[model samples]
Target chain A: MTVGNTTTQRSADATATGAAVEIDQVAVRFRTKKKDVTALRDVSVRIEPGEFVAIVGASGCGKSTLLKLVSGLLRPSSGQVRLHGEDVRGPRRDIGYVFQRAALLDWRTARRNILLQAEMRGMPRAQARQRVDELIAMTGLTGFEDAYPNELSGGMQQRVALCRALLHRPPVLLMDEPFGALDALTREQMNVELRRIWRETGTTVLLVTHSIAEAVYLANRVIVMTPRPGTVAEVIDVDLPVERDYGQTMSAPEFARATGRIRDLLGATTTAE
Target chain B: MAAQSTIEQPERTAPAGATASATRRPGGAGAGLLRFARNTWRPAAVLAAILVVWWLVTAADLVKPYLVPSPGTTLDVVLAQPGYFAHHTWITTYETVLGFAIAIVVGVLSAVVMVYSPTVEKSLYPLLLFAQVIPKIAIAPLFIVWLGFGLSPKVVVAVLMAFFPIVISTVTGMKSIDPEMLQLSATMGAGPAQTFRKIRFPAALPHLFAGLKVAATMAVTGAVVGEFVGANEGLGYVILQANGNLDTPTLFAGLIIMSLLGVLLFVVVELLEYLVLPWQASRRTDATTTTL
Candidate 1:
């Protein structure tokens, strides 16, 4: 992935290829009419290339804010968020964001929404069309490509959203509680699909979710965050093997242990706050 | 998502109120027709009863024939001078259409400007509301003063009347977009123009069409009001001359023709909405069913 802004040199260990994110003492403040609210404070983390990282936190823990900072959607009030080796100044084409809701354009058909990436980039029509067909197939949305968003079920709509995010093949993917809206069974199934896709594409992913099970099931490392003026409370590494299946992962002892540890950390943070 | 039941889902129900008989499962074409007639007959019966009461009133001379012409006499007048009514209808139709077209362009452009800039919205929104409060009928004569007694004055009045609703609805539609949708677009590297073209505009279309339907009927009234003040042609002029001469049948004929013009325009707008926003039309649920 090509980095931006040459003024700051790359860190010695950061690579020239593969998407890498470095959050250096990042902070975000909202200046409201009544007072200044610190959304995030001195939050620092690094995501290596192709690593699947999940952040688990309560509502006001600034998990979504961190994702925004990484995607260059929000500027850090202090320090910097770097993609690859360069600082992120604004939105770039190399990052993909999947919102909590499917958020598909209701007017556009499923295929057209996926091709929105190409439309935004001014990519060649023929190439975009070919890519759209492949993504529809990849996301198991073959027959439903022409369907409007309202015609699809909630889970199907989220699948369409996933296809749209992955259409441009961005080096880094950021997801904010993507499966949180689905029912339990569908959410588990989608978790399986997401893991399979991540394994296949080897794209670096940073997912923020409120579900502890989801964070442990999907990521190599789960970042537990504290609430209000949010900062990282603990980073728990998942010792489970990379080749995880929904059924097997849930039953595994290591999975239980990792989730239990993160849960305890979260419980303690909320009480202390 | 796992497929549920999968019995083809009954061909997806038509938009709400479009198919009251659509719920009935019919064994044959005859049954389908009977069901359709059953759903439609109530309204038809009410209309027939009203007509009967009117005829009885006329026969008993409850009201003067000149003041309130019998429905039959109005029909006869309409049949007698079809060409004259048609000429005036065409003129009124042109003015309404032209004014509506101009309103759509100017209103939507203004809405876009206001949506994109906070300063413009703050300054212009109250003024738009102010313009909406002043009755368009009151200003119809002023348009004639500036543009003279021609098609321009009538068209101007129609535009002034139709413009506010379109702008209000368009602005509402643009702002109603989910914040997540905007954030997703930003992450996709979409510039302002691209976001508006592909996302905001298309999403706003259903609301825009809703406003257009209201504006379409308003346009006809606006044109007629302008004609009421000063015009040599149009159904409004026909009505005014007939009223002066106490030609009640001709006046009633003019009123019918003018209203028919408005209804036709409204239907045309609805058809356009269906074509452009099939997704929205198809997704509508029955209003009663949607109550919490």
Candidate 2:
């Protein structure tokens, strides 16, 4: 874990970018009415600047919990989560999050939804408007800026959610299966769009997903976790080309091999448990 | 294969033919207007039928005239002795508006406090429930005794009658937000106050409006009941006076006016809801278009 941290920091510094996040021996437990359930145990991961890392696990593997811990929405029962080497006792403004559901306020238009995050951060209206315009154009939402969430398709609403997450230009983006609710074809298209956006913005992204192909295709490295009292099972370096086209990459040998290995790891863990 | 071909052919041809036929209808705007009228005309016709039935029932003396007077006689009473009920109606309207405004302010403030402090909610919620459960009419006389008969007693009665729904509704609205949304806001480093203002408040608006609509209708009834208890002015006082004299037409006239006021207030609330939630309207319109 120490070696991993140094490598992460060295690489982060070498790239002239600061260490974005560090999670040191983090553990989370939930006390229900009946019993205490351990969600994550002895999980340590360091996400370097500009790295796209995907955390992949089956249900009950605490993947979402890990995302929450890093985003500072939940504190680890033990260990520490740090942003830029500073302890994250609570949520930080430098990290943006997108949920599986769009979760757009039904009453607000797409433009207003984007403005919400900006407003919460106390950005002036003039600055917010400029950021909103850039995001709308970047997300291809120029024509539908005034449309409400209910007026949009599931895919479009998710795009709006993505734009909202990007509005503040956070150094780290935490996404928990943002495309999970979308249809298969739309989800695939969203994956392609997300990769494009991530590359363009050079933002470090920590995404949690159940799809092995999705994790393998998007991440520079995929962290696999064990189920129930989840710990990092293995961290596999994805050797596929960084710049990817969805259709072409899926058929590439490297992509298939990476996906197959992650799938086998997941299967082995599931069967063992 | 042959049957499948026949089935598939019509499936393709029917939609194409239908589209062609629809486009061939040159007066599309007129047809659209005709469709609109056809839809609206049914409800209008039903209302007319209801009015006719009501007039006939009253005209034929199917029910006691004292209970259900003829529409003409009620109208005549309204026109000739309009001043008789006017003062009372104005008084009731004033009480309703004033009490309703106070209820809104107090209810919203309480809701904010309750949401911010569980202790406040825990302590006050049961008391509110107990107050709500009490028969407001039974307390009307007590209010008159305590506050006197000028306007204070009546307004207090109106407030008591209409306060519960607003508070309960506002509290529920303030608390009922998506957990994920709260999480999102929290992760964005938003504090409690920011969370409430930016996320929870806007999200709870539909629920708040729902409570307001119910409260508005109740306000009218509250004012009338308050007037009935002990007041020299207001529609309720006039109705009570008419009843004492056995002037059935005048009583019916007052009742009709009160009913109209209630309907008018409800419509105003609905109109406000429509204005405040235009996004809801657009969504509804979208749903209709998609269904069509």
Most lDDT-accurate candidate: 1
lDDT per residue as tens, model 1, B202-287 = 88898899899999999999899999999999988999999999999999889978887997898788766655665565555323
Q: Which ten residues in a row have the lowest lDDT in candidate 1 chain B?
A: B13-22
Q: What is the C-alpha RMSD of each candidate to the true structure, in Å?
A: 6.5, 7.9
Identify the candidate with maximal DockQ.
Answer: 1
Give each model a TM-score: 0.88, 0.88
Q: Give the range of the ten consecutive residues with the poorest summed lDDT in model 2 chain B.
A: B1-10
Q: List model 1 lDDT by residue over A1-273, tens digit each.
A: 212222222353443443488887778999999999999987777777888889988897799999999988899999788899788999767888898899999877778888888888888999999988877666666556666676677777887888888888888999999988888777877788788889888889999998899899998888888897998787787888878878899999999999999989988887885
Question: What TM-score does chain A reach in every model?
Answer: 0.92, 0.93
Docking class of 2: acceptable
